[model samples]
Target: MTRSCVVSVGLLLLAVSTLTYGQGLLVVTDPDQVVRLPRPILIWPPDRPVVRPEPPAAYKIKQLEVNARLLDQVAQVQVSQSFTNTGSRQLEVAFLFPLPYDGAIDSMTLLVDGKEYPARLLKSDEARKLYEQIVRKNQDPALLEWMGTGLFKTSVFPVPAGETRTVSLRYSQLCRQHDGLTDFLFPLSTAKYTSHAVDEVSFRVTIESAQEIKNVYSPSHSVEIKRPDDNHATVTYKTKNEVPTEDFRLFYDVGKGKVGTRVLSYRPDEDDEGYFLLLAGPKIESKDNEHQKKTVMFVVDRSGSMTGEKIEQARGALKFVLNNLREGNLFNIVAYDSEVESFRPELQKFNEETRKAALGFVEGIYAGGSTNINAALRTALAQLQDSKRPSYVLFLTDGLPTVGETKEMQIVDNAKEANDVRARIFAFGVGYDVNSRLLDKLAREGFGQSQYVRPNEDIEDSVSRLYRRIESPVMTDVTIEFAFDEKHEELGKPVSRVYPKGSFDLFAGEQLVVVGRYKKAGPVKVTVRGSVAGEEQKLDFPAKLARHSEDETAGFIEKLWAVRRIGEILDELDLKGKNEELIEELVKLSTRHGILTPYTSFLADEDTSIRDTASNLRRADRRLSALAEPSGAGGF
Candidate 1:
C-alpha cells in the first residue's frame, strides 16, 4: 500500500514533465498558423463494402514501391512512388504518417520539382489524450479520417496536367523513451488532393522516442545543439550506443480549412495494429452497426485488487453494454474472483427485463478473491458459444491467471483452439498487475483485439465499445485468396485475415488492401465464406493478377506486419528457440522504419521517480533546464 502511493506520485510527476515539455514545444509554434499540406486520396474501385473500409477514393495509384532495412533496433522506410494527376483540377498531394510520442527527424531527403529540400523538424502541436478522447467521442469517424488530428500532418505536392509526378522522400529518426504501447497518430494540418501508396520499407530502431520526449521508463542520452536560427541539431538515444526509433509524420493540408482523415489499421487487409489520420476540426463519434445474431458476454474479474473506482467503473461498463443490447439479441454476464459465476451460463435473449436483471447482477458483484482469468474465459466462452451469432467474449481482469490455466501460453493455445466461427474473445488488461501479453495474445488469436484499461479509465466506455463490435459485422466470411502459384507464396501463408471489428477498430475505418503476386497473367478468384445471421454466404471476387518480383512483393504490407509482429516477439524473448536471423533482420528493419522493437524498448520512457524524496539529488540538472535562462547569460 505504501509503495503504491510512491509509484503513483512518480507517474504523476512524469506525466507533468511530459505535459510541460509538450506545452513548451507547442508554445513555440502558433496553433493558428504554420506551413500545412493535405493528404493525397486513393481511388478505390466500386464494390460491395467489406467488413473493413474501402481505401481512400481520391488518390489514383500508379506505381508504389517500398524498401526496408534495419540497424540494431531502428527501422527505416524508403518509399518510391509514381503519381499522376488523374483528375482535371490541379492537385496537391501529401502522405500522412503516424508519429510515436517520443520521436524526431534523423534526416530527411526530399526531391521536389527536381530540387532537393531538407526538412526542418518541429513538433507543431501537443494535446492531452483527455481532449483527444472527448473530441473523438463526439466526432464523426469519417470526418476524422478525412480531416486532421493533433499529430497528423501532410506532405506537399502540387501537380497539374496529366503528367506523372515522381517523388522520393527519405526520412529517418531516433527515439529517446519507451512506452509499452504506442499508437502512432498522424494529424493533418491542411487539405489537398489524394495520392498513391508508394513503397514503404522499414529497418530497425537505434533508440526509443519516449525516453527523449517525456520519460516515464528510464533515463536516456539526448543531444541538443542550438543552431543559427530556431532549428536545433537533435539526436537522442535510449542507450549509450544505439540508433533511435523516431517516427516521421507526413501531412498535406487544404490551406482554406478543407482537410481529410483516414482512421485505419496497419495492413488493413489483415488485423494489424490500428493506424489513423485526422485532419478536420470536427470531433469523432462512436458507432455500433447492428449485425445479425449478436451475443455479448461480459466476464468481469472482481478480485480484491479492484476495490474502489475500478469496481464501480466495471459496473458502469457492464450496465452500458447491457443497455445497448438490442431486442432479440442474446447476452450473458459473468463475474469471478477466486470462483466463477455467470448470470446465465447459456445465452439469454436481450429485453428490458433481461437488461435490468443483468444490471442487478452487476450491482451484486463485489471485489472478493484471487484473479482467475482462465476460469473466466472458459466460462465466458461457454456462454458465448450458445448461439450461432457472432458471440463476443469480453474478459476484464487485473491479475495473473490462476485457478485454471495459469500459464499464459497455455491459455492462449486453449483459447485459440476454443474459438469457432461463433465466438471471438476480447481481453481487457486492467491495471499494472494484469499479464497484458497473455490477454493480448488471447484476443489476437481469438479474432478480437486487446486493450489496456488503466486504473483511472472508465469501464463504461470500454464495455460499451465491446457491445458495439459485438453487433457490427459489415461483411463476414472475409477470406483472401492469392491467385499466384507456389513460387511466390511464402513457406506458410495465412489462409485468411478476417475478424469482427469494433468502434476503435471500426469496420469502415480499416481499409482492406489485399496484396499478392502471380506468375502468369491469368485471372484468379478469391472465394469468401461466412454467415451473416445463422445462414452461410459465399462470394467469389475476380481480379487481374500481376507478377511482382520478390523484392517488390516485400513492401509496406510486409514491413508493417513485420514491425508489428517483431515488437510482440521481442516482448516474449524469454520463450527462446526463435530464429536469430529473423530477430536480427527485424531489428534492422525496425531501425529504418523508426519503429521500436524488443532491442529498442529502452527508448520508451525514463525511470526516474519525481516523487521519491530519496531522489532529491537528481533534480539538480532538471531544475537548471526547467527555468528559462536569459539569452545573454549563457556565454552570449
Candidate 2:
C-alpha cells in the first residue's frame, strides 16, 4: 500500500519563529498589534539521511544554529537561507510558510536584493491535522510537521530567470515537546502546566540572492530589535525580571564550568552535549586497569537494517574500537538476527592472536534476517556472568526490539538490573532508526554513556568524541549541591554541566546564564563526585552564583530555561490536547528566546504540515529505528 501522508507546518515555523526571538507579552487585543508579515520557509528536510554518492542538498544549509537545554525541554535555533529563481522570465515571487504547533509567527517581512517588502501569514491550519490528530479544530499537529510548499507569504515580487534573489529573515520562538521522532508527537503540556519566562535571543544573519533586484533596508519591528539591512538584523530580550523562588541564592545556569569558548576537534563541547546530561543526568567515567583484567562483550546487530554501507561503517567503527582493547581485557561478541550467535560460547581470553581472529570474524559478518535485540542482550549478559571479570557490553543496533519476548520497557528494566551485577553497558545509536530513548535509559542504568552517529556525517568524529569522554572524567557522578544564599533569585530549575561550550549545537559561543531573580549574596560552591572506572573521585568548585548576570552567560542560562518551558508546552499539545492560547504564548516565548516551538508553523485552519517531508524522509531512511508505522522508517 501507499504510505500514509500529511502536510507539514512546524517545519516552516522553524524559519518564522526567529522573527519574535526578542519580544514579550505585548498581548495584542487588536489584529494589527503588529504588521502581519508574509511567512517564509525552507522546502527541504534539514536532517534528511545521506545516501551513497552524496548529492548536493536541495535546500542549501543557508545557516543553522540550534542550542538546546534538554532538561529545560526548550530549544532555540537560527536558520539563514537563500533561494534560486528558475523562472523563464520575470515572474512574481510568493511564499507559503507553516508555523509550529506550539509556536507563533511574527516579524514576517520579505527582502529582495537589499530592499524590504511586506509579508503576511494569509493561510491557516484548518484542514491539515483533521487527518493526523483527533481534535482537528482545537489543535494543529500540522504545526509539528508542517512546511509550506505551495503557499507563499511574500508580496508578489517580480524576478528574472537564471538569476538568484536574496531573501533574509529574523524571528524567534518557544515550543513544547513531542513524542516519537516520527509522525507521532507527544505534547508535554497535556495535564496542567504553564510558564512565563523570556531570555536574550540573537544570531547574526546574512543572505545571497540568485535573482538580484530591488533595494534593501531593515524596518523596525518589535522588542529591543534593530535591523541594519534586509540581510542583517539583531534583537535582544530581557530575561525573567522577578525570579520565582525565595529560599536559597539562585544563579544563572551554565555548563558546570567557566563560561568560555575554544577551538577543538577531539573533545565534546559542554553545550553540544546538552545541559541535562552534564547536570541532572548521570555522570560518566571509564575504567582503566594496568593489572585487574576485564571482559568486554561486543553486541553486533547483523539484521537487514544493518545492510549496505551503514553496516560497513558500523563494522569498521566496531573494529576501530576493538583495536584499542588493551591486553588482559577479556572480550566476547554477540551477533544477533531473529535469534542469537556468539563470537564464542563464552567470554574469550584477551590476547593478540584471539583479538585478530575476532576482527577477522567481524569482517566476514554479513546482514540478514529479522531483529532479536533482547536475546542478544541476554546472551551477552550470560557470557559476562560465565566470566569472572568486570564486563562492558557495547550494544549497537539500528532498529527497534522487533523479534523478541522482551518488551522495550522490560528491556530497560532488565538492563538496569543487570547493571547492579557490576556490568556496564554503553549504547550507540545509528541514525534515526534506533530507539534513542531506550538507548538513553540503558546507558544510564548501566552507568555508561550514549552516543548517536548520523549517516553520511563523520562517524569517526562521533566515535572519537565518545572515546574522549570515556578517557577523561573532569568530574563524575556529579550532583550539584548549592544552598541558596538568600533566596534572592528564584533560580529556575538549573541544568549543570562542565565541558567546553562548543559541543552545544548552538554555533554562537556558550555562556552560562540563570533564569531567576536575586535578593542576597553569599559564598557559593558546587560539589560533584563520581567513579572514574571502579575508583571514585570528587571535586568542589567555587562558583559565582547570581540572581542576574546581564552579560553573555545569561543568554546561555535563559536558552536553557526556555528548553524547559518548551517541554511543558509539548506536553500540553501531546497529552492534554490542543490549547491554542497556551501554544501561542509558547510560540511567542520561543520566538523571543531564540528557541524553536511548534506554534510558529502550525496553522489551525489548513491541513498543511511538514509531516510529508519528515514522513518521506522516514520512508527514505530504511535504516531508521522506529517500528510502529504510519510514519515509516525512523529518524536521522
Candidate 3:
C-alpha cells in the first residue's frame, strides 16, 4: 500500500499533506489497490504502522510558488508546486483538492505537466465522511481542521523513482471585505509535514482597483511593495531553505479623497468588547500646492565629547536636512555647547539664498565646551512663532547634560514651558551615555518619537531616513473620533484604549494604523480632523463594529491589539515607578497571548499559574528591578 497526498482548499484554509503526516502532506497512493479492496488501502489499515519509522525521503516538496491578481473585491490565484520522489520504488498517486466551504468558486482548473486532468467535485457531506474516516483510521487530529471543506478528487498518476512531478491549480473567487478594505489570505504553514526544509517559496500579488489604493499592509510578514500608480500595486515576498510558520495575509483600501480611512473589527464573544484597527493615509500623488508648509528647527549638540568623527557626522546630517527643505518651508538651526548659538534670530523662509547661508553655518559648527540640553531646546522653541503651521525640533545629543540646569526633570519642564506653539521634538540620542528615560519623556510630551543610533551606525543615515518621512506633511495635529449612531447612543463610548495616545501627523506616501477596543457592535461614524496648510480640515467615514466573529481570518486583529497593549504597559513600567495593577495586566496578557518579554518569560514554565495574579506581579517586580540599566545603544 502507498501513502496518499490530500490537498484541501477552502475559505480561510488551504493545506496539502500526506495521510501519514496529517495537515500539509504530499505523498503517493495506488488508486487500483484502493478501489479493489473492501477498505481503501490509503486509509491506514490496522496492520500498517501509524507513523513513518524514519524520514520519508520518497516524497518531498521542492518549491512552492503562488501568484495572485486582485481586482477590487475579486481575486484570481494560481498555485504551482514541484514534488520530487527519491525512493527506490515506483509509486502511483491520486491527487485530492478541496474547494472553499461557501462553494463560491467561479472557475477552477488543474494541470499536471501541462496536460489537463479531469477532476470530480465532492459536496460537503461526502468530503466530511471521507475526512473523518482517514482521521479515525490514522488517529491524527490535524486532519480534523479540513473536515468541513469540500473536495476535488483526481485520477491516478505514476511517479518513477528519482524524478520530479509538477502540479498547478488555478481558481478565482470574490474576496472578503470589511469596512473599506479588501482582505486576501494564502495558507503557507508547512513546517510540520516534512522533515527537510523546502528549497524555495515565493509569493507575488498584484492589486488593481477602480478607485485609488491608499493603504497596503501585511502584519504577518515583512513584504516589499511597489506602487506604479495610485490604482495599481505589486507586493512580493520570497524565502529560501525554510519552512513557513504562518500564513500570508494582506489588506488594502481604496478611496478618491485626499486622505483615505479604513476600519476592521473582530469580537470572539457576544458579551465582550471587540478589537478594531483603523488605517489612514494621504494620497500617493499630490500637487506642490497641496503640501502643508512646516517649520523645522534643528538643535545640534557640539559638546567637547563629540570632537572627532561624531561632530563630522552631525555636520553632514545637518547638510542633508538643509538640502531637502521645500521652497516655502520655514527653517532655522541652533547649535549648543555650554552656550547656545543660532543661525538666525527667527525662522526664515527656505529660499535658495537662505539655504546657502544655512549650509555655511552648519559647516562652521565645531565641537567644544560642555553640554547644555536645556538652553538648546529653549532657543529652538522660541523661533517657532507660527502656531498655524506644523513645527518640529530635531534635537540631537550624544551625552548626559553636564552644564547649567542639568536636572532631567527641570530640563523637560523648561522645554514644555517654552513650547508655546506645540512643536514636536524628535530626540536623536547618538550614543549610550545619554539618559534614555529623559529622551522618551521629551518625545512623548512633544508629540514625537525618539530614535537611537548605535556605535556602528551612521548618524547621517538615521537622520535622513526620518527626514524623508516628514518632508511632505499633508496634515498635522491629527485626531480621530468614533461615535455611535442615533439608535445606539446608549452604548456610551464607542471605543477606548487607543494606542498612540495623543494626536499624530499624517504624511504623504505613509500609512498610520491605530488599534483600539470597541464597547458595542453597531453602526459608527468616524471623523478625522487635522490641520492642513494652516486650515482645519475634517473627513468623515461610516463603519460597522462586528457583533461576533469566529472567522480565523479576523483573528489577527486581536493578536495585534494585544501586542501593542502589552508594549504600552511595558513602556509605562520602564518610565514610571512599578505599579501592581499594570504588572498584573501585563502577566495576564502575556500568558494568554503567549507573548514572551524579558520580564515575563517565566510564564513559559508549566507550574506558572496565570490565575495567581499577586504572585506574578511580585515576580515581575523582582525580575525588572534586578535587571541593570543597559549601557550600549539599548533603550525603551
Candidate 4:
C-alpha cells in the first residue's frame, strides 16, 4: 500500500549548537538573512522489500540565495531556499540542521512564505537521542555526521502534493580570528541529498572594518571581489544549474602599514609539526611620489614560426605593456631571431615621446629567422644597470633554441652571468614547439616564474593579464624571518620549509601568501624585509603558534601547505629528474591529506589500501614509468 501525508514544520529554534563541516542538507535564506536545515526524508514501512523497493521521494531545490553583512567580527547572515516535492505521494518531512563543531549563533529566526513558525529547541543530549532514533529506524548514517550538535524540532502540518515551499533563515554570529585574519565560512555542499541540481545559487558577502582591510582571499572558489575603499569590500559568487561540491571559505586581514602581514597556523596533533600560512601585501592607498620606480624589458621572439597570428598577438602584448608603463619607470624592448636587436641601446626612461617611438619600432618588426633565446636573454638582462631599481625581463619565445648557445644549462648560466642587477625574468613559452624545461629553468634560476600558452590561447591576454598584476611594484627582493623567544630557542628552528623558497617582490593591490612548517608553539616575531626604491625597509609583527590542535576551521591551512609542498616536489621531479626520496614523500603526503595528484590518483580506487605502503609504492612506480617524457607545455 502507498501512503500519502504532508508534514509542514512549524517554527523551530536551536541554541548553543556546535557548527562543523559536513554536507549541508538544506539551506534557505531570504534577501537579507540565512537559515539551514538538514535534508528531510519520508518514513517508509519496515517490511518494504530490501532490494527492489520503490525509491523514496525527495524534494528538489529550485533556487538558493545567501546574503551576509559583516561588521568587524560580527556577521548577520540570511538564507532563502525554494524547493518542490517531486513525488506524487504526500510525505511527512522532518528538517534538521547541523552546526559547526566550535561555532555558535547569537540569535536566529525562521519564516515560511512570510509567516513566522513557532518551533521548539532541543538541547544537545536530546538532539543526539533524536538523531540516533532517525538513524536506527532509517538505517541511514548521514545524520551521524552531526550527532553531537543540538537540533530544532517542530510539529508537522499538512501540505498538498506538487506545491512549492519557500523557507528563509536569518542568524547572527561572531566570526573567528587567527593572527590578524578573520574567517567566514558557509556550507554549500548540497548535491548528495537533493533530487536534482539546484537551478540557481548566489552568495554575496559585504565586509566592513574600522581599520583598512589588507588581504581578502578565498582559496575554495573563484569569486569576484571589489574594494570600494580600504575599509569596506564586497565578495560575490554566483552559479546557474550547478551543484556546489565544496563549502565557501574566505579570509581577510585588516591593519595599517606600508606593508601588512598576517599568519594562520594549524596543528592537528601537538606531537607533530604544524603548518602555517603567511599573507603579506602593500597598502592600498599611496601617493604618486611614494610609488616605487622600476625597470622593465620586454623580450619578444620574432622567428619564422611566429610569422602569422602569433606575431601580431606578440606585438599587441608589447603595446599593452608600453601603454601601461609608469612615469618614473625605465623600460626597453629586445626583439630577437637568429640575432638580437633592441628598441634602444640602453633602458630608456618612460615618457610620452619614448613610448611613441617605441610603438613605431614595434610596428616595423617582422618574423623571419631562427630563435636565438640565448642572445635575447643576455641583451635584455644586460640593460638592467641600476641595482637599486626593481627590474624585470619579460622573455617570450615560440620555438626551441636553434641558433646561438642552444644547450639549456649553458643558456641558463649565460643569462645568470649577464643579470648583474638581479632582474626577475618571466619566461613565456608560446606554443608546444617551445622547450618548456629550458624556459622553466631560466625563470627558476632567474628568480621569476614560467608561463605557457597553448596554440589556441591568446598570448596577448596571458601577458597583459600578468602585467596588470605586477604593474605597481611596491617592494623588491622581499624576505621573511620568524624568530622565537630565547627560552624557546632550544626547541630548534621554530619554522622551516617556506615556499617561494627565496626572495620575491610585492606589488600594490596584490597579496602574497607564504606557507611553511613550524616546529614549536609559542610567541614568535615575524620580520619582513624588502627594498623600497633604493633603500632597505623592515617591518615586524608579533604572532603565536598553536600549542594544541585547533578546530576544523583552521584545517585549511594544513591542506593548503600540503598542496604547495606537493607542487614544489613535482617541479623538482620534472626539472632535476626524479629521486626516490621525493617520490616517497609525494605518495605519503598525497595519501595522508587526501590530495590526489596524477601520480597518486590510485588512492581513489576502492581496492587501494592506504595502509599498504608496499602496494602504494609499486603503484607510484608504475605511474612514474609512464611520465618519462618531458611535458609538452609547462608541467605534467
For residues 1-636, what per-residue lDDT tens digits would candidate 3 score against the true structure? 000011232111111222322223444322222321101112332344445443342556677788888866556677766665566754333344443322222122233344432221222233234434533453211111111112333322345567665555555544544335676766566453444566787889999976788899997789999999999999999988776766677889876455456688988778777888886664535456777788889999998988999999999999999999988899999999999999999999999999999999999999999999998998899878888788889999988788888876678778989999888888887764666557766887788877767455688888997788677677788888899988878878899988767788776555566778987888899888887766788888898889988674555566556656776675667546699898778755544443333233210111212243222221223333322322100101
**Number of colliding residue pairs in each model:** 121, 138, 6, 26
RMSD of each: 22.9, 18.3, 18.3, 17.1
> Candidate 2: minimum summed lDDT over ten consecutive residues — where?
184-193
Kindly list the per-residue Cα lDDT of model 1 for residues 114-194, writing each as its tens digit: 443332211111112222342344320000011111023233334454645444333332211111111211211111111
- Each prediction's TM-score against the native? 0.46, 0.47, 0.53, 0.54
Which parts of model 3 have CA positions greater than 4 angstroms off? 1-260, 282-285, 324-329, 349-356, 399-414, 431-441, 452-458, 563-578, 581-599, 603-636
Q: Give the TM-score of candidate 1.
A: 0.46
> Candidate 2 on 4-90: residue-level lDDT in tens?
011111111112111111111111121112222122111222333434432211211122222212122223222223344332544
Task: At residue 299, give the lDDT of candidate 2.
Answer: 85
Q: In model 3, where is the ten-residue run with the lowest total lDDT?
A: 140-149
Cα displacement (angstroms), candidate 1, residue 416, comes to: 2.6
The full ranking of all candidates by TM-score, starting with the best, is 4, 3, 2, 1
What local lDDT score does residue 448 receive in model 4, on the 0 to 100 scale?
79
